[model samples]
Target: MLDLHTHVVPAGIPFAASLAADDPRWARLERGTTTGDVLVAGKVFRTVPRVAWDLHHRRESVEAEGGTGQLLSAMPELLASWAPARQGLDFARAFNDWLADELPGHDGFFTGLGVVPLADPEAAAAELGQIAAAGLSGVELPANPPTAPLHAPEWSGFLDEAERLGLLVFLHAVGSPAAQWFPQPMAANGVLFPNSIGEGVAGLIATGALARRPRLRILASHGGGSLPAQLARLDFLRDITPPLQELMPEPATVSARRVWFDPLLFDTGLLSHLVTTVGADRIVLGTDYPFMPVDPVAVLDDPALPAGLADAVRHTNPGALIATLRSHVQQRS
Candidate 1:
């Protein structure tokens, strides 16, 4: 299986002790702790598992699960979302260089997705070359970048760079101010998190991003979040609502299908519906592994699913993306 939605934390943080409290470069892991209490600026951000960074353990787990390989993204918490532009770029370059060294080609089970500091789109655009030089396939950009707006006017240059490099832009959601409004963590993760992806989709369409940069390839996580469910409304309302009619240049579904989506929705009915909504070519198999105990391959294999879907998500769709990734690397060489 091409498990695209996996994450990794550094097995060890370099020089966590001396950095100033204001610097968010490398996260500080509490010394001598095996449980991975990842501290950002001396505060506990999140505790991750050994599967996050242990190659032997992770490869063994993927192999046991019948996975061919998985794409490794720096856990979103490590992305330095709100850090200063130069510092965030520095962190991303260093962090991603470390990830490039861990790819499956080096007897590990990871195909890496590099991180970029999207808070500064100009710096983020320039960082693509360094990311490519590190031999990474793509970038893990935040669905809701803290300082930078997602509108096309502000972000088209970054999109242009990604398209020029033939890079896959994985629009994964991270914690945002809206999540804090929820009363419980579960409500934030289960309700608010997925909906953030829909906002990303809306940004792409309403902001004239895809209209301006048609070749840009993106893969949004969580079954394109709420987009598959709401696209028909976007498609319908564009013709009637004056503001939406002006903002949306094409059918929202058309723009949505230009990107790929992961089938990590918890429901089979929703999965099947998504396949029909976006078509099989745009769907890829992605399990938030170690985070979700359920078997991703088995989810595709469920008798409830349409036949041949398992093979499509497992190989065909992801194979196309991987092919472009490797080709870009080869051209760089």
Candidate 2:
């Protein structure tokens, strides 16, 4: 399986110290804590130290689990989105440089998606160009900024550049301040479900980002963040709402299909629904590895899926996507 949503950390990232920083977002909001030998979010994550990006270790882990290769990128926490644009850009460059330097010539077992600073578009565009030249496969950005949606005019230039360069844009969910919605309190001290994957998708669609970057190959993490369930509502609004009709004249499913989704939804029911709604061609395999050890085989082995669908999700689709950026690198060389 291609495993499109696994995360890796740059060697330069301070794994332990970054937890104790004064940033309230990482402190109060996410509440990082050490447990036995792993780190668990006060709310949603439980991860081991080994998961932090050792290619040898990852290869062994995947081989043990019966998978073939991993498509790796920096985790949302590693991106440090709460930091200022300049700092975020620096972190991105350092992370991407480390990936380029380390992952090649390792039996082609590892591939990478570069990180870009969405907080500043011009700088991000330049960084995107640099990453493309460096032979990275794609660029990663947050699903939405804490303060604003990605479609805000300030970020359109970066989207434009990514499309022009034929770079795949990957959007991962990051920490948010609003988290008081879950019925049961899973964590002793932090918020839960303030705004979820669904809300992020709504924000992206409402902002007209898909319309703006028509040809950009964009993938949304965590199964497009609650989008499969909300398609009916979006279609209703598009059919009746005059303003929305003007903005998105096509059926809502068309826009939904234009954006691909990774299979990071842990629940089988939800994953199946996402595949049915988006079609098998648009669904890609994503384990969100190291954060959670989702069984790739179990996800693909389900009886609900049609024949050949698993092969597309596991290999063909993502290989094609990565090949797009790889071709750019070949031309540059």
Candidate 3:
């Protein structure tokens, strides 16, 4: 299986630590006597097995389940975009370096996405070249960032730069403040992570940001989150709302077709509905490796999926990111 949506926390933190009494901020992995814990802001983030960083163990675990290879991402907590701009950018660059060193894995089987510091939009935009030069294919972006809204002018450079570099973008849910506006700053996801991807991606489309980044290949993680279910309502509103009608060149459903999604919604019926909405060709496979207990492949390979479509997602549809990684590795060889 070419499991694309997997994560890892390096067993070490090469950077210095900030252990303050009143203010604590840092992201690292602490290896316990037996297991390891991912720590963000000096708090225990996730207690993970060696599979989180042990390359041999990770490969063995996947092979035992008949998986051929896995793409890797740094754990979300490591993104640390909530930190100050320079601090966040430092973490992202360091993490990208660490992740790139692990790639072309054990004979070209492993590839991964680097993380960026959205708090510093310009720096994040500038780091894409370093990420690519380091042998990474793309970067994972937080769906909602504490900076200016993704559709704001500041973010256009970043999005356009990613497109120009042919970088793949995977937007993962991260509940965040809608913007830096204080006193009455709105929260993007009132319920935190659950509603983030939907509101974030939908806002981009409604505000015409996605349209601006016409060539940027973005994947809406977690089955486009809640966006897929709200397409009909958005389309209806667009048809009636004069401003939205003028802003959106296409209906919300058609606009959504430009984005890619994975079938990790955790429901068979919902998966079928996603296929009906987005078409099978736009779907990709992701197992979220070392996190889920059961075989994540079972979701994509479920008998309930349309005939032969599941096979297409598994064998043929590795998506732009993996395909780019393959080309990068080939060039190096």
Best candidate according to TM-score = 1
Model 1 spans > 4 angstroms off? 14-20, 23-26, 30-35, 41-45, 104-109, 241-247, 296-298
Query: Would you give me the overall lDDT of model 1?
Result: 0.77
Lowest summed lDDT window (length 10), candidate 1: 13-22
On lDDT, who's better, 1 or 3?
1
Alpha-carbon runs more than 4 Å astray in model 2? 14-47, 180-195, 294-297
Clashing pairs in 1: none
Error of 2 at 221 (Å): 1.2
Instruction: Please identify which of the two predictions, 1 or 3, would achieve the higher TM-score against the true structure.
Output: 1
Q: List CA RMSD, all candidates.
A: 2.6, 4.7, 4.5
- Write candidate 3's Cα lDDT for 139-251 as tens digits: 89878776876767888888888788777788887755443443441253324554778877888888777776677778777777788768899898988899988888778
Give the distance in Å from residue 104's predicted Cα in candidate 3 to where it truly belongs.
Answer: 3.6
Query: For candidate 1, lDDT tens digit of each residue in 1-333?
Result: 777888877765532333334565557665333456777666787776677777667787788868887888877777777677766766776688778766734553467888887678888888888888888888988787776556646677888998888788899976577778989876788887678888887778766688667878898988877877678877787878888767777788778778888888877888888888778888887887766655644567788898888899988888777777788888987
Q: How high is the CA lDDT of each candidate model?
A: 0.77, 0.69, 0.74
Give per-residue CA lDDT, model 2, range 268-294, as digits (tens): 777778878878888888877866644
Q: lDDT for model 3, on a 0 to 1 scale? A: 0.74
